[model samples]
Target: MALLLKEFSPAELDRIIEMAWEDRTPFEAIRHQFGLTEESVKATMKAQLKFSSYKRWRQRVEHCRTKHLKKRDDSITRFRCSRQRAISGNRISKR
Candidate 1:
């Protein structure tokens, strides 16, 4: 997992971290975009975040039903918010 994570640019890593933190962004979406499994995403978060932050993130993820595709509502189809504009150059456009 470390080697796989190494291939990402700093910006990509940041985006992965951001997506992991989003309640509605499932692990499948991260895997689709970054080729990381749920375990690998957890590893990336553990490696990149402080211990306290990692713990909090884990707790939050465990409680967030939307973070896992199977647990998410079928009505919610997209990985991102409907209000969010297209991403350009790795940056999500500001409203």
Candidate 2:
């Protein structure tokens, strides 16, 4: 089900967009707080942001700084919690 949007303000929407665009932010952050999935976040971004901005954000993430040890590809790496993995690495989510 789609998350209800009634309580959100423009400021909150902007915050969401900023968090989504931030390389350090995680999908789990939005998922935990707002019950939004990655797909939902993407849809929101597309609907609320300019096409050019969205494109740039996506490109930035696709070329983000960190690399995935197992995957060996930064572009495909998913930002997630470090506790889930035995090896120490940049955890996508934080307490």
On lDDT, the leading prediction is 1
RMSD of each: 2.4, 7.9
- Screening candidate 1 with a backbone cut-off below 3 angstroms (N, C-alpha, C), the clashing residue pairs are none
TM-score of 1: 0.86
What clash pairs does model 2 have? none
Off by over 4 Å in 1: 88-95
CA lDDT, candidate 1, residue 58: 100
lDDT of 2 by residue, 14-94 (tens): 666766876655666667656677787788888777999889877875676432133235564555444443322222344
In the range 1-95, model 1's lDDT, one tens digit per residue, is 66867799999999999999999889998888888899999999999999999999999999999999898889988777877677754567776
